[model samples]
Target: MKPGTFLKSTALLDGTFFERSVIFIVEYNDKGAMGFVINNPFPRKLNELEEFKHIIPFPLYLGGPVDQEHLYFVHRRPDLIEGGTPVDAGILLGGDFKAAVKHIDEHTLTGNDIRIFIGYCGWDDGELDAEIAEGSWEVLEGGMLL
Candidate 1:
């Protein structure tokens, strides 16, 4: 629906990889909906990557079935990470990457305050509504599970 809302896969997704997945919505509007799987962690840590091999270890998650070539992130430490768009009362979507890494290196930002993803989930205009109508997902809010 809107940012800060979470979409949880229902039994309808039992036969797919999205079964039991929980997605954190970062952007949503008439254009479409976009979010990242809060669960579904990847096998490798962020530092294992070639470009960030020197940074401190951070868990990487499989956001969704969309474009996985690029990396994305969400965080809560706006005071430490600037330029991010607020998703909820305490959450934010995207911001200064260099500053984030620098803070992580400086021990100011920990994994608890951030989540990295290889890709992101997306839905075209009205596509998500169709899925919801089909009972593929259950909406959750304020950190509560459905």
Candidate 2:
């Protein structure tokens, strides 16, 4: 992986999207990319929302164009769940869904501690690199380098 790649649990660089939008990448590989929009803050609250009601109070995100209904999250606190992989300093990605639900049920996790997102942005293999080469995307260090 490259530096400033956002890794797993790191927040998307600021000013990269709508105001205050923060994204967390969940899966990144040759197949494509996937993550959640953590900071978008839709008009609805968790209790008032359906679909992900099982994870009440967990903030929702605008992941991207891929699977808008799919759910994903990123957390820095690994002790709260199992199966998470370390992405970078102070960040952890991926985890057991049941563990996460238990944490939510027990009130051990909150929106600030973890972010939930629907949908995701993606690029087929070599597509991202091509975008960079074509100047459609810019690579920068430390935060959203548009």
Query: Which structure among the candidates has the greatest lDDT?
Result: 1
Query: In model 1, which regions exceed 4 Å deviation?
Result: 144-146
Candidate 2 lDDT, tens digit per residue, 45-132?
5555664476556545566657766666667678877777766555566587667767876788875566655666666767756645
Local distance difference test, per candidate? 0.86, 0.56
Maximum-TM-score candidate: 1
How does model 2 fare in lDDT?
0.56
Root-mean-square deviation of each candidate, in angstroms? 2.1, 5.7
lDDT of 1 by residue, 25-119 (tens): 88889999998988898999988989889988878899988999988889889998889998886888889988998888778888788888898
TM-score of 1: 0.93
Pairs of residues clashing in candidate 2: 13-144, 37-61, 64-120
TM-score versus the correct structure, for each prediction:
0.93, 0.67
